[model samples]
Target: MIRVLLFADLQEKAGIREIEISAEKLTINGIREHIMELYPQLTAIKTAMPAVNEEYAEGEQVVKAGDIVAFIPPVSGG
Candidate 1:
């Protein structure tokens, strides 16, 4: 299973901070799509950045079982 970590507003919108998906290795885009399907309320999630094993991941980055994937939403400060 692939472990997913949600941060900031993404976590609030989804009402959860973590999730696990049972599937073969999935690309960053694929994981984004899966999240959207599971939590449509997180509309802003599409713009979130995906990370694998604590490093930023690219669109084609592959996330495999036991990997820690995180979705970091945009944040701003004054």
Candidate 2:
């Protein structure tokens, strides 16, 4: 089980801030796919950036069970 923190549209669309997926080692790409599966409106999640343990991560980043993953969309504020 992995802990995922949703943000912005993701939270609004899914009505949940965190989710636990059933996987031993879930990759960044795999997370996107799972998110899209859970929230069909978030298909664009594949283009967003994800972080593992508060560090910038890539599409192929490996997320093991018990790891904390944060989903961060592009930031823009003045």
Candidate 3:
């Protein structure tokens, strides 16, 4: 299973900070889509940045089983 982490408003919207996906493999973009299906309330996820193993990942980055993925929502501050 792939572990998914949610942060900021994403976590609040989903009502959870972490999730485990049973898929053996999925692309970053696929992960985003899957999460959206699971939690339609998290609409901001479409623009969230994905990270794999603590490093930023591209949309096409492949995530394997046991990998840790985090979706960080956009933040604005001044």
Candidate 4:
């Protein structure tokens, strides 16, 4: 079970900040697709940077079965 932490409007839209997705079929792209499927309000998810184990990661980044995933939304505040 990979944990994904959401923020900003995403949490509200998805109704939870943290989620456990099956790592077997879980990819960064797959997560985004799931989010889109759950919340159609999110037209785009690219603005968010995916972080795994405390470092910025790519879409194709491989995640372990119990890794921690953070979906960090871009912040504009100074």
Candidate 5:
């Protein structure tokens, strides 16, 4: 399973901080698409930054089973 974490607005919008996807492997973009499918309310996910195992990952980065993927939305404060 691939563990997915959502933060800030994404988390609030999805009403959950984590999600588990049963898949052997998927690209970061694939993960985003899956999350959107699971939680259509999280439309912002399309622009969220993806991190794998705590490091920023590209859209094509492969994520295997047991990998941790986190989607962080842009933040702004003044």
Candidate 6:
């Protein structure tokens, strides 16, 4: 299982900060697609950035079972 971290308003919107999913060997893009399919409310994440192991990751980066995947939405502040 891979641990997925949701940040900012996504956490509140999803009603959870994190979740575990079975996505061994799937790329970040694949995970994003899966999330969109499962949770239509989080469709905003379609344009969000993905991170793995605390580092910014590419869409094609494959995720391992023990990896932590985080969907980071664009932040705004002034």
Residue pairs in clash, model 5:
none
lDDT of each: 0.90, 0.86, 0.96, 0.77, 0.95, 0.88
lDDT of 5 at 9: 99
Off by over 4 Å in 6: none
lDDT for residue 15 in candidate 2, whole number 0-100: 88
CA shift of 10, model 6, Å: 1.2
What does the lDDT come to for candidate 5?
Answer: 0.95
Cα lDDT of model 2 by residue, 1-78, tens digit: 999998897777788999999899978998888888888987547766789999989989899999999887776789
RMSD of 6: 1.0
lDDT of 6 at 71: 93
User: lDDT per residue, candidate 1, 3-77, as tens digits?
Assistant: 999999999988999989998799988988998999989887788888899999897998889899999988989
lDDT of 6 by residue, 1-78 (tens): 999999987787889888888757889988888887877799778778899999999999999999999998988889
Query: Which candidate ranks first by lDDT, i.e. highest?
Result: 3
Clashes of 2: 0
- Model 6 residue 9 CA deviation (Å) reads 1.6
User: TM-score for all predictions?
Assistant: 0.94, 0.89, 0.97, 0.80, 0.96, 0.91
Error of 5 at 9 (Å): 0.3
- lDDT per residue as tens, model 3, 9-73: 99999999999999999999999999999999999988999899999999999999999999999
Which pairs clash in the backbone of model 6?
A: none
* Higher-scoring candidate on TM-score, 1 or 5: 5
Q: Looking at model 2, report the run of 10 residues with the lowest lDDT sum.
A: 41-50
